[model samples]
Target: MTGKSEHDDSEREFDYRWARDAPHKEPSARARMLAARWKENPPEPVPFRGEPEASGPRRSSWISTALVLGCVAAIILLLGYTRFQAPY
Candidate 1:
């Protein structure tokens, strides 16, 4: 029973060979309208400054270095006091 139905479907199926020779048409109406609007009012490019400030002797990391050294010194002091001094 299924085989007969399959044969009938195969006979009624659409042929796709003609699509290869069909001529292509221009863009759809909606696409043309959108393109025209974009062409008439395109978006502006974002403003950008020249070469970003060079890393020349103009920048300093002394503050960051001092903070790190301070943290290390505090940790070392706490450890030494805990080991050598009597607990309160």
Candidate 2:
């Protein structure tokens, strides 16, 4: 029968505390090589939805305006249909 202690005597206790005051070791050779490689060849920018980003915002605002108008028209139609078709 085990006694009312947290851990058994034979069991090794794992230290979960971070050693904040411990000396920082130099980066490993592999880490240094990776850093150097990254410095030489940086990662390319991710493609925007499989397409390159526009160099400038040369796109006209008319498309967005038309979309907004279409949404408003749909909402008006829905409201009108619901109001007029009510079984009062």
Candidate 3:
């Protein structure tokens, strides 16, 4: 095999001459008509409807929060007590 590695060979060059030399195409008749119509009469902006405000003051129920915390504490205490009494 040749002592030179694959990377040693020159990289292939890309031909961008076609893009630089290509002619620009004109817009179609239908496309032109639509563009003219859009320019003459544009659509109206939709009305923004904000969310309705709550009837009463938004406050968390203290009773519900306290109950949830109590349940979590009781679960932790029960688990700890069971682990302490577990057989060695």
Candidate 4:
């Protein structure tokens, strides 16, 4: 059996119920003052600056194509030169 007595269990249950049903307290003076001030003069929304538009023409795809073709050509030429120079 558990060590706790029936009295202790009832006391804990009563405390829990009391805390759960507790009344809500009134707002503090500072909170009420700020709320009143906001009601009197609500703040205006500040306008955000939009992103800048693209100023110049976009780069062409041919530049990247040419770069890849040049790399492949260089690799091919290097392999050919090495194969010829290697002694049998």
Best candidate per TM-score, number?
A: 2
- TM-score attained by model 3: 0.33
Residue-level lDDT tens digits of model 3 in 1-88: 3545544553334447754676985788998998899899976675698667789975579978998999999999999999999998
Q: Quote the positional error of residue 87 for candidate 1 in Å.
A: 6.5
Give the TM-score of each candidate. 0.34, 0.42, 0.33, 0.35
Number of clashing residue pairs in every model?
0, 0, 0, 0
The per-model lDDT (C-alpha) reads 0.83, 0.78, 0.79, 0.83
Q: lDDT score, residue 15, model 1? A: 63
**Candidate 2 vs. truth: CA RMSD?**
6.5
3 or 4, greater by lDDT: 4
Candidate 3 wrong stretches, greater than 4 Å = 1-60
| Candidates 1 and 4, the one with greater TM-score | 4
Model 2: worst 10 consecutive residues (lDDT sum): 10-19
- What is the lDDT for 16 in model 4? 59
- Which pairs clash (backbone N, Cα, C closer than 3 Å) in model 4? none
* Per-residue accuracy of model 1 over 1-88 as CA lDDT, tens digit each: 9999999999888767765566875788999998999899986685676657667664359877888999999999999988888766
